[model samples]
Target: MPRIDWRSDSGSAVAEFSMVAGLLTLLTLAVVQLGLGLLVRNTVLDAAAEGARHAALADSSLPAGEQLTKQLIATAIGEQYAADVSASYGTWHGQPCTQITVTTTLPLIGLIGVQHGLEVTGHAAREVLD
Candidate 1:
C-alpha cells in the first residue's frame, strides 16, 4: 500500500475561482440590465418631449399631432417597448400641451418568474405666445 498526500493539490484554486466566477457573472448581468432600463427611461422621456413639441405647433392638426407623437415614440422605443403607450393633448396657460405616458416591462436577470414593469410619464408644453 502506498500513502498519498493531497495537501499540495493545486486544483482547489481552480475550483474556488470557478465558483466565484459564476457569482461575478450574475452580478455583472444584473448591473447591465438595470443600466439598460435607465437608458430606456431617459430615451422615452426625450422622445415624448420631442413629440409634444411637434404637436404643439399651431400648424399641426389634431390627428397630425397625435400621429407625430406616436411616430416619435415608436422611433425611439421599439414597437415592443412602446406597446400600450398613450398620449393626450391639453391646454396649459393658454398654450397647447402634450402629455405622453409610456409603459414597458424590463427583464430581470437570474430571477425566475419575476419582472419589473414600469410606467414613465412625460409632459411638454407648447411654446406658444400668450
Candidate 2:
C-alpha cells in the first residue's frame, strides 16, 4: 500500500488562487478608479472648451462664459463637479482670447474623494474685428 502526501499538495491550487484573487481584485479596482478619474477630467475639459467658445463670441461676456461653463459641467457631470470654475482673458500668439479654467477635485474611491487632486483649462479666441 502506498501512502499519499495529502498535506503536501492538496488544495495548493485553491490556496494560490485565493492569494492571487485578492491582488487581481485590487488591480481591477485601481483601473476602474483611474478610468473614472479620466472620464471626469475629459468631461470637465470639454465643458470648459464649450464655455470658452460660447464666451468668445463677439457678443458674449466673461461672466456669461463662466456661468455657461458651470452650467455645462453641472449638466454633464454634477453640480459638485463644477463648484470651482473660472473664466479669464489672455493673449495667445499676440491675439486676444478667452480662457476658461475648471479646477475640480479628483474622484478616488468615488465622487468627492480627493481634495484638489486635478485641474484642467480650456481656451478660445474671440471674433476679431476685420
Predictions: Cα RMSD each: 3.9, 2.4
Report the C-alpha lDDT of model 2 over 9-52, residue by residue, as the tens digit.
77799989999999999999999888988899999999999898
TM-scores, all candidates, are 0.71, 0.88
- lDDT string for model 1 (1-130, tens) is 9877788776788999999999999889889888776777677667666666666666664445446656765776566655645667776677667766666655455212123376666666755556
Q: What is the lDDT of residue 51 in candidate 1?
A: 62
Model 2 lowest lDDT segment of ten? 110-119
Per-residue lDDT of 53 in model 1? 63
Candidate 1: misplaced stretches above 4 Å?
4-9, 90-96, 109-116, 127-130
Residue 113 in candidate 1 has what lDDT?
Answer: 19
Q: What are the Cα lDDT values of the candidates? A: 0.64, 0.88
lDDT of 1 at 106: 59
